[model samples]
Target: MSTKYKKLILSLILDAIGLIPIPFFDVVWAPASAYIMTKMYKSKEGKIAGILSFVEEIIPFSDIVPTFTIMWVYSYIINKEKVDTIVEA
Candidate 1:
Protein backbone atom coordinates (compact mmCIF):
# COMPACT_ATOMS: atom_id res chain seq x y z
CA MET A 1 0.00 0.00 0.00
CA SER A 2 1.00 3.60 -0.47
CA THR A 3 2.38 5.71 2.35
CA LYS A 4 -0.68 7.97 2.30
CA TYR A 5 -3.08 5.12 2.87
CA LYS A 6 -0.78 3.75 5.56
CA LYS A 7 -0.90 7.11 7.30
CA LEU A 8 -4.68 7.18 7.04
CA ILE A 9 -4.93 3.75 8.65
CA LEU A 10 -2.50 4.72 11.36
CA SER A 11 -4.45 7.88 12.06
CA LEU A 12 -7.65 5.91 12.37
CA ILE A 13 -6.03 3.52 14.79
CA LEU A 14 -4.64 6.36 16.84
CA ASP A 15 -8.04 8.04 16.97
CA ALA A 16 -9.64 4.78 18.04
CA ILE A 17 -7.10 4.30 20.79
CA GLY A 18 -7.72 7.82 22.01
CA LEU A 19 -11.44 7.14 22.37
CA ILE A 20 -11.00 4.70 25.21
CA PRO A 21 -12.64 6.06 28.36
CA ILE A 22 -10.07 5.13 30.90
CA PRO A 23 -9.87 7.71 33.66
CA PHE A 24 -6.82 9.99 33.66
CA PHE A 25 -5.40 8.16 30.68
CA ASP A 26 -5.00 11.51 28.92
CA VAL A 27 -2.16 12.41 31.26
CA VAL A 28 -0.03 9.83 29.48
CA TRP A 29 -1.71 9.59 26.10
CA ALA A 30 -1.95 13.33 25.35
CA PRO A 31 1.77 14.10 25.10
CA ALA A 32 2.42 10.85 23.30
CA SER A 33 -0.29 11.58 20.78
CA ALA A 34 1.11 15.06 20.21
CA TYR A 35 4.54 13.62 19.46
CA ILE A 36 3.06 11.00 17.20
CA MET A 37 1.06 13.61 15.32
CA THR A 38 4.15 15.73 14.70
CA LYS A 39 6.09 12.71 13.50
CA MET A 40 3.29 11.48 11.27
CA TYR A 41 2.60 14.76 9.47
CA LYS A 42 5.90 16.70 9.60
CA SER A 43 5.91 20.48 9.02
CA LYS A 44 4.44 23.68 10.42
CA GLU A 45 0.99 22.26 9.92
CA GLY A 46 2.01 19.12 11.75
CA LYS A 47 3.28 21.13 14.70
CA ILE A 48 0.02 23.06 14.89
CA ALA A 49 -2.04 19.92 14.60
CA GLY A 50 0.04 18.25 17.29
CA ILE A 51 -0.77 21.06 19.66
CA LEU A 52 -4.43 20.80 18.81
CA SER A 53 -4.34 17.02 19.33
CA PHE A 54 -2.69 17.46 22.69
CA VAL A 55 -5.33 19.95 23.76
CA GLU A 56 -8.17 17.81 22.44
CA GLU A 57 -6.94 14.71 24.23
CA ILE A 58 -6.23 16.56 27.45
CA ILE A 59 -9.67 18.09 27.73
CA PRO A 60 -12.39 15.96 29.34
CA PHE A 61 -14.86 14.44 26.88
CA SER A 62 -13.00 15.95 23.92
CA ASP A 63 -11.11 12.86 22.90
CA ILE A 64 -13.92 12.05 20.49
CA VAL A 65 -12.75 14.82 18.13
CA PRO A 66 -10.69 12.49 15.93
CA THR A 67 -7.85 15.00 15.57
CA PHE A 68 -5.52 12.63 13.71
CA THR A 69 -8.07 11.77 11.06
CA ILE A 70 -8.94 15.42 10.60
CA MET A 71 -5.28 16.33 10.26
CA TRP A 72 -4.80 13.55 7.73
CA VAL A 73 -7.65 14.89 5.64
CA TYR A 74 -6.37 18.43 5.93
CA SER A 75 -2.83 17.46 5.01
CA TYR A 76 -3.59 15.06 2.18
CA ILE A 77 -6.85 16.30 0.75
CA ILE A 78 -7.47 19.94 1.58
CA ASN A 79 -3.87 21.05 1.52
CA LYS A 80 -3.07 19.04 -1.60
CA GLU A 81 -5.33 21.19 -3.72
CA LYS A 82 -3.48 24.33 -2.72
CA VAL A 83 -0.11 22.75 -3.41
CA ASP A 84 -1.29 21.46 -6.76
CA THR A 85 -2.58 24.85 -7.74
CA ILE A 86 0.70 26.46 -6.76
CA VAL A 87 2.65 23.96 -8.81
CA GLU A 88 0.39 24.43 -11.78
CA ALA A 89 0.77 28.19 -11.69
Candidate 2:
Protein backbone atom coordinates (compact mmCIF):
# COMPACT_ATOMS: atom_id res chain seq x y z
CA MET A 1 0.00 0.00 0.00
CA SER A 2 0.93 3.64 -0.21
CA THR A 3 2.93 5.27 2.54
CA LYS A 4 -0.07 7.41 3.36
CA TYR A 5 -2.27 4.38 3.85
CA LYS A 6 0.39 2.70 5.92
CA LYS A 7 0.77 5.77 8.08
CA LEU A 8 -2.98 6.00 8.59
CA ILE A 9 -3.35 2.35 9.48
CA LEU A 10 -0.37 2.42 11.81
CA SER A 11 -1.63 5.48 13.58
CA LEU A 12 -5.06 3.98 14.05
CA ILE A 13 -3.62 0.70 15.31
CA LEU A 14 -1.29 2.44 17.71
CA ASP A 15 -4.06 4.67 18.99
CA ALA A 16 -6.26 1.62 19.56
CA ILE A 17 -3.49 -0.28 21.29
CA GLY A 18 -2.67 2.70 23.41
CA LEU A 19 -6.19 2.78 24.74
CA ILE A 20 -6.48 1.30 28.24
CA PRO A 21 -10.25 0.62 28.04
CA ILE A 22 -11.30 1.38 31.62
CA PRO A 23 -9.00 3.27 33.95
CA PHE A 24 -7.28 5.85 31.77
CA PHE A 25 -5.86 5.61 28.28
CA ASP A 26 -6.98 9.01 27.14
CA VAL A 27 -4.29 10.42 29.39
CA VAL A 28 -1.53 8.52 27.63
CA TRP A 29 -2.86 8.11 24.08
CA ALA A 30 -3.76 11.76 23.70
CA PRO A 31 -0.20 13.01 23.94
CA ALA A 32 1.37 9.92 22.47
CA SER A 33 -0.81 9.75 19.37
CA ALA A 34 -0.87 13.49 18.97
CA TYR A 35 2.91 13.67 18.98
CA ILE A 36 3.14 10.68 16.69
CA MET A 37 0.70 12.18 14.20
CA THR A 38 2.12 15.65 14.44
CA LYS A 39 5.58 14.48 13.57
CA MET A 40 4.47 11.93 11.01
CA TYR A 41 1.90 13.81 8.94
CA LYS A 42 2.86 15.45 5.67
CA SER A 43 3.77 19.02 6.53
CA LYS A 44 2.34 20.37 3.27
CA GLU A 45 -0.97 18.62 3.60
CA GLY A 46 -2.55 19.75 6.87
CA LYS A 47 -2.03 21.85 9.98
CA ILE A 48 -0.44 19.10 11.99
CA ALA A 49 1.12 21.32 14.64
CA GLY A 50 -2.03 23.32 15.08
CA ILE A 51 -4.06 20.15 15.48
CA LEU A 52 -1.56 18.83 17.96
CA SER A 53 -1.67 22.04 19.89
CA PHE A 54 -5.44 21.90 20.02
CA VAL A 55 -5.30 18.38 21.34
CA GLU A 56 -2.67 19.34 23.86
CA GLU A 57 -4.66 22.32 25.05
CA ILE A 58 -7.66 20.21 26.05
CA ILE A 59 -5.69 17.35 27.53
CA PRO A 60 -7.12 13.77 27.46
CA PHE A 61 -10.77 13.99 26.53
CA SER A 62 -10.32 16.88 24.17
CA ASP A 63 -8.09 14.94 21.81
CA ILE A 64 -10.64 12.20 21.28
CA VAL A 65 -12.48 13.88 18.44
CA PRO A 66 -9.82 15.84 16.58
CA THR A 67 -7.33 13.05 16.35
CA PHE A 68 -9.86 10.64 14.88
CA THR A 69 -11.10 13.28 12.50
CA ILE A 70 -7.59 14.13 11.35
CA MET A 71 -6.79 10.52 10.72
CA TRP A 72 -9.99 10.12 8.76
CA VAL A 73 -9.17 13.24 6.84
CA TYR A 74 -5.71 11.92 6.08
CA SER A 75 -7.06 8.66 4.80
CA TYR A 76 -9.78 10.37 2.84
CA ILE A 77 -7.41 12.81 1.21
CA ILE A 78 -4.97 10.14 0.25
CA ASN A 79 -7.59 7.87 -1.19
CA LYS A 80 -9.32 10.66 -3.01
CA GLU A 81 -6.09 11.79 -4.57
CA LYS A 82 -5.31 8.29 -5.66
CA VAL A 83 -8.68 7.89 -7.30
CA ASP A 84 -8.36 11.18 -9.07
CA THR A 85 -4.93 10.30 -10.34
CA ILE A 86 -6.15 6.96 -11.59
CA VAL A 87 -9.07 8.54 -13.38
CA GLU A 88 -6.86 11.11 -15.06
CA ALA A 89 -4.28 8.56 -16.04
Candidate 3:
Protein backbone atom coordinates (compact mmCIF):
# COMPACT_ATOMS: atom_id res chain seq x y z
CA MET A 1 0.00 0.00 0.00
CA SER A 2 1.07 3.56 -0.72
CA THR A 3 1.85 6.06 2.01
CA LYS A 4 -1.29 8.03 1.19
CA TYR A 5 -3.56 5.04 1.72
CA LYS A 6 -1.72 4.19 4.90
CA LYS A 7 -2.31 7.71 6.18
CA LEU A 8 -5.99 7.42 5.27
CA ILE A 9 -6.35 4.20 7.23
CA LEU A 10 -4.50 5.70 10.18
CA SER A 11 -6.75 8.75 10.09
CA LEU A 12 -9.85 6.55 10.15
CA ILE A 13 -8.51 4.63 13.12
CA LEU A 14 -7.67 7.82 14.96
CA ASP A 15 -11.11 9.23 14.30
CA ALA A 16 -12.75 6.05 15.49
CA ILE A 17 -10.66 6.09 18.64
CA GLY A 18 -11.62 9.69 19.26
CA LEU A 19 -15.26 8.64 19.28
CA ILE A 20 -14.89 6.75 22.52
CA PRO A 21 -17.42 8.14 24.98
CA ILE A 22 -15.37 7.74 28.11
CA PRO A 23 -15.75 10.87 30.24
CA PHE A 24 -12.66 13.10 30.56
CA PHE A 25 -10.80 11.08 27.99
CA ASP A 26 -10.80 14.13 25.73
CA VAL A 27 -8.74 16.08 28.24
CA VAL A 28 -5.87 13.67 27.73
CA TRP A 29 -6.51 12.53 24.17
CA ALA A 30 -7.05 15.96 22.65
CA PRO A 31 -3.47 17.20 22.74
CA ALA A 32 -2.03 13.82 21.87
CA SER A 33 -4.35 13.49 18.88
CA ALA A 34 -3.48 16.99 17.74
CA TYR A 35 0.21 16.21 17.86
CA ILE A 36 -0.41 13.03 15.92
CA MET A 37 -2.39 14.93 13.32
CA THR A 38 0.39 17.44 12.81
CA LYS A 39 3.01 14.73 12.49
CA MET A 40 0.85 12.55 10.28
CA TYR A 41 -0.13 15.25 7.80
CA LYS A 42 2.77 17.74 8.04
CA SER A 43 3.10 21.26 6.43
CA LYS A 44 0.88 24.27 7.06
CA GLU A 45 -2.34 22.46 6.26
CA GLY A 46 -1.47 19.83 8.81
CA LYS A 47 -0.78 22.47 11.46
CA ILE A 48 -4.13 24.12 10.81
CA ALA A 49 -5.99 20.83 10.86
CA GLY A 50 -4.14 19.82 14.02
CA ILE A 51 -5.38 22.96 15.77
CA LEU A 52 -8.90 22.31 14.56
CA SER A 53 -8.71 18.71 15.75
CA PHE A 54 -7.50 19.82 19.13
CA VAL A 55 -10.37 22.25 19.53
CA GLU A 56 -12.95 19.83 18.22
CA GLU A 57 -11.85 17.06 20.55
CA ILE A 58 -11.56 19.34 23.54
CA ILE A 59 -15.10 20.60 23.28
CA PRO A 60 -17.66 18.38 24.94
CA PHE A 61 -19.61 16.08 22.60
CA SER A 62 -17.74 17.39 19.56
CA ASP A 63 -15.36 14.45 19.20
CA ILE A 64 -17.66 13.08 16.51
CA VAL A 65 -16.30 15.67 14.07
CA PRO A 66 -13.71 13.19 12.75
CA THR A 67 -11.25 15.96 11.98
CA PHE A 68 -8.45 13.61 10.92
CA THR A 69 -10.57 11.83 8.35
CA ILE A 70 -11.92 15.11 7.09
CA MET A 71 -8.37 16.40 6.66
CA TRP A 72 -7.45 13.25 4.77
CA VAL A 73 -10.38 13.78 2.39
CA TYR A 74 -9.43 17.39 1.92
CA SER A 75 -5.81 16.53 1.26
CA TYR A 76 -6.31 13.54 -1.02
CA ILE A 77 -9.66 14.24 -2.68
CA ILE A 78 -10.44 17.93 -2.67
CA ASN A 79 -6.89 19.21 -2.93
CA LYS A 80 -5.93 16.55 -5.45
CA GLU A 81 -8.70 17.72 -7.78
CA LYS A 82 -7.53 21.29 -7.61
CA VAL A 83 -3.96 20.26 -8.33
CA ASP A 84 -5.05 18.06 -11.23
CA THR A 85 -7.11 20.85 -12.70
CA ILE A 86 -4.23 23.25 -12.43
CA VAL A 87 -1.93 20.77 -14.10
CA GLU A 88 -4.41 20.13 -16.90
CA ALA A 89 -4.75 23.83 -17.48
List TM-score per model, in order: 0.89, 0.49, 0.87
Winner of 1 and 2 under lDDT: 1
Task: Judge candidate 3 at residue 59 and give its lDDT.
Answer: 97
Q: Residue 2 lDDT in model 1?
A: 70
Q: Candidate 3 residues 1-89, lDDT tens each?
A: 97677877899999999999998999999999999988876667888988999999999988889898898889888898543322110
Q: After superposition, how far is residue 88 of candidate 1 from its true place, in Å?
A: 24
Better of 2 and 3 by lDDT: 3
Candidate 2 minimal-lDDT segment of 10 residues: 80-89
With a 3 Å backbone cut-off (N, CA, C), the pairs that clash in candidate 2 are none
* Candidate 1 global CA lDDT score: 0.85
1-89, model 2: which lDDT tens digit per residue?
87546656765765555444555655655565656555554453334643564465346544334454455565466456633222110
Error of 2 at 64 (Å): 6.0
lDDT (tens digit, per residue) of candidate 1 on 5-89: 8888999999999998889999999999999998876677788999999999999999889999998898778888543322110
